[model samples]
Target: MTATDDAAAPPLDVLIAGGGYVGLSLALALKRGAPSLDVAVVDPAPAGAAARDGRASAIASAAREMLTALGVWSTLEPLAQPVEDMIVTDSRTRDPVRPVFLTFAREEGSAAPFAHMVPNGALVAALSDAADRAGVTRIAGSGVTDFETGTAFQRITLADGTTRRARLLVAADGAKSRLRALAGIQTVGWGYGQSGIVVTVKHERPHHGRAEEHFLPAGPFAILPLPDNRSSLVWTESTETADRLVAADPFTFAIELERRFGHHLGAITAEGTPRAYPLGLMIARRFVAPRFALCGDSAHAIHPVAGQGLNLGFKDAAALAESVVEAARLGSDPGSADALSRYERWRRFDTVQMGMVTDGLNRLFSNDSPALRIVRDVGLGLVDRLPGLKRRFIGAAADADPSAPRLLRGEAI
Candidate 1:
């Protein structure tokens, strides 16, 4: 259904708040899996805003498979840079030598790399375009202002005074989800007092598809490879320090960036304005309530130390869509308690496990304690030396779990 026809349209089966990659993908997945369902997405950002985003993300293999199954991966593959290998180092900012304690390399003749780095703009554009082609109604430039869940539907009010009812209202509206709060769903979380500075950097030399994560006193400084002679940086620091650095003059900022970025890339230059996002660990106390559910950042927000934030969101999208689509196929209400419970059950353990992992990693690595450093470094070294264990770790991150959603396993729902 097009936005033009929305006025006369029937109540939707699913109304997703937020049109980021997660929301868009979920809408597409639902429509593709069950075209009879009415799906729509609403976001405050104007249409085409995603095309201008300068940030990038690491798409795990499982996410790539889901995109492929949805027929969106081919369009995105050209803009993606496969991660050939990764090296992890632990050291202080000024340390002359940052020793690589752990390394993960793609095996020869491997079917695919574990992950690929793609720009945020490209990803969202592809997902949005595919969603449009899939007949998913997209209402941009408006957000859900208020919502009330009735016994049969969720009455959602838009900022523009538009009212729409949906059997299921999925809040993918991000970490500070207004819909989640409106649903009386509390979140268990705390600010880490750290902020991640994201910036794209151009380098004279190619990265050869290698990603790096350096554990510094402030936090993990990640250099994720992108296509061309560029890389995306996620530099974490104390909230106050991050704010100051982002406001620093270009020259001063570049100097400080170099202190952590190092000279390996050679003649690096910032490509866009640096932005800092406060980091935290947040998980909604309940992922569902009546005719309401939460996905993506609305459900759980984790540290980017492991670059799993977006992948986790994709996981939620796939899982939730699978549950809803299956219910619809069975002639049951897609938003029924059974369907919501299945989604929550399928996602809860994974969400909490990842949240704890990221939180623990941030605490263990984002400090200057001498004793802790030794222990973590030794642990990393031991894991690196064990090929079987390293492969298992890579498989886990790549979403190789056999019980994952059909879409994540490169199959249709």
Candidate 2:
């Protein structure tokens, strides 16, 4: 239905220009935290489209808590696969045997596994359902084509010729966000000349919730466990090599996959079409513009080596929602410069920090320099033996930032 369906339709409090995880979560978070606020999500995809996404993500502990706070985790728990342990190794694809240089197992008193391997589809489905139940509007099969900023509200023109006026507009449209560009926000980043080949594989033996990250010379090759003896693979390689691998015949691809996967999982076969995505780091210079704000990949897109991309997006959702809801409750304009500045300040530093970490990691590990390899291996070995350091690292991965928004810390805004 159009926003003008009712004679007394109120202006939207927030208009999200994307319906992915970040956008959907933001809508739900706002609706739950400030029940009186009107929120709507605009996207070209129909509802449930995310459920068909074959890729899976490693949801960090803090992000999991945010989901739980939003009431989306219960629906996802049954389909989720906890990562009971993690093994990191540095080796060549042709090495006789990969030796683990670093290991992280669930400590007796640890809050939970560092993260959980969840299907992107399942996570999106849960978020969408929760948003619907929370009274957030989903304008599917259309996207925000253009928006005009005004003193009081931003008038958004959708692809379907409908107009929505909101106090604030958020661009969660992704790394190549059209809204970001329209707002004249430029990003600084470069391609790694690498592409990640993603696919799912069914193994003959159970993985037992073990996740492995093998730091091959090309890049990290991750095997994240899934339910039903299946695992998600993120295989990184040079762009040329990735193209060849993905285009190879099934038998040829399987042979190459088996070489890197090893025999520990017994026999394994591809479960779906293998896809390749280019690797890069893109950080928008500014996260906010007047009544507009950027979220998710629109704000910062980092390498997948640490698997924190999704988590960072979730953090943005939580932070922005809190900032807006708090402003509204205080009888202030949610889209005012002050509220938008708060969100930018809260998320920009953390996003930049994570971007640097992932970029440095990709450069350090995605290479064949013998000296560098030795230094990294030694470093990993040292961290492995240092209990205090290991725990601290795991805590950082699982815990929210010290200045994290309330929702991210499992508290209401």
Candidate 3:
């Protein structure tokens, strides 16, 4: 049926653009968190099967907590490899600081794993399942084309020409969010001088459930353990260098990687084609405008050095949903400017703080200055020895109580 036809249409309280991790997951969170609300997510069309050859994401502990709160942690648990510890070292240094270890099991003194390293496909699939269980209408192969505001609601037109009048129009459409543009939200961001190349590698030795970060002069090269003995690689470098390497022969690339990544994995062979993603930080000058709000990659895209980008997005989703739920209980329009502004206030400070931290770390560690080399190494060592200091950093990174949603708190949001 055409959009204007006098046909049955889904009544939605929230119309979200983009069906990627952020959009779909938040849909489930809202549906599960506020069962009475109508949450619908509109994507391009038909769910595409997970792509194994392309991209992958490192799911942190905090991210796992959110997913668990949504009630699908056990299903996802099988596909992930537990992160038992982490090793940080200088790319050119001969001996690393005996590897600083931090694991959920180690820190919490329980059988639970610290974090799970799952593929992007697995993560997306899990969110899709959650959406299904929550009865979120999946409007695939469609997107917001335009919208008109009527003081109380936003009349949205999708690419399929469907009309959706929603209390809130959320932009989870990714780094380049069309919905955000339509809402007139502005962003302040700049690109790093680097590009990140992500790939999977089969190492000769097992990764031992360990995540490793090599702080090289160009950027950070991360080797994260995955299910089985294989490891996921995130190698960052100058844009030009990254481009050349991604286009280089596999053997040539493997040799260069071994030199920088270290052969500790023993006779490592690279697999999968490399994808070079330009690094940057994009923070919306404002997270909400009028009847629309931003979440996930739509609102802020930051450097992945800390592997906190997705975690941050999940945090946004949980917080936004919680605010809306409470507002509804209090007999207020959850999508009002006032309601959304609260979300912006809660998230903006944290987002900006993390962006600055990651940017500064990228700049400070991605160099070979003599003074910096000594100072930074000492900084790394100092954190390693002080168990109290190490625990705080680990807890913070693991998503322990930092303006998170109840779902992020390992609770039902």
Sorting all predicted structures by lDDT, with the top scorer first, yields 1, 2, 3
The TM-score, computed over Cα atoms with residue i paired to residue i, of candidate 2 is: 0.97
lDDT of 1 by residue, 25-44 (tens): 99999999999999999989
Q: Which ten-residue region of model 1 has the weakest summed lDDT?
A: 1-10
> What is the C-alpha lDDT profile of model 2 across 1-413, one tens digit per residue?
22443213567888898889999999999999899998888888876787789899998888988999999898888888999999999999889989899998898987678789888988888888888899988788888898888888888888877787888999999898999999999899999999999999999999999999999999999999999999999999999999999999999999999989999999999998999999999999999998999999999889999989999999999999999999999989889899999999999998999999999999999999999999999999999999999988787777646678888788888
User: What TM value does model 1 have?
Assistant: 0.98
What lDDT does candidate 2 reach at residue 65?
83
Candidate structures ordered by TM-score, highest first: 1, 2, 3
Which run of 10 residues does model 3 get worst, by summed lDDT? 1-10
Please give, for residues 328-362, the per-residue lDDT of candidate 3 as tens digits: 76778868777798899989999999999999999
Per-model CA lDDT versus the true structure: 0.92, 0.90, 0.80
Query: Could you tell me every candidate's TM-score relative to the true structure?
Result: 0.98, 0.97, 0.93
Q: In candidate 1, residue 151 scores what lDDT? A: 88
Better of 1 and 2 by TM-score: 1
Cα error of candidate 2 at position 202, Å: 0.5
lDDT of 3: 0.80
Task: State candidate 3's TM-score.
Answer: 0.93
**Number of clashing pairs per prediction, in order:** 0, 0, 5
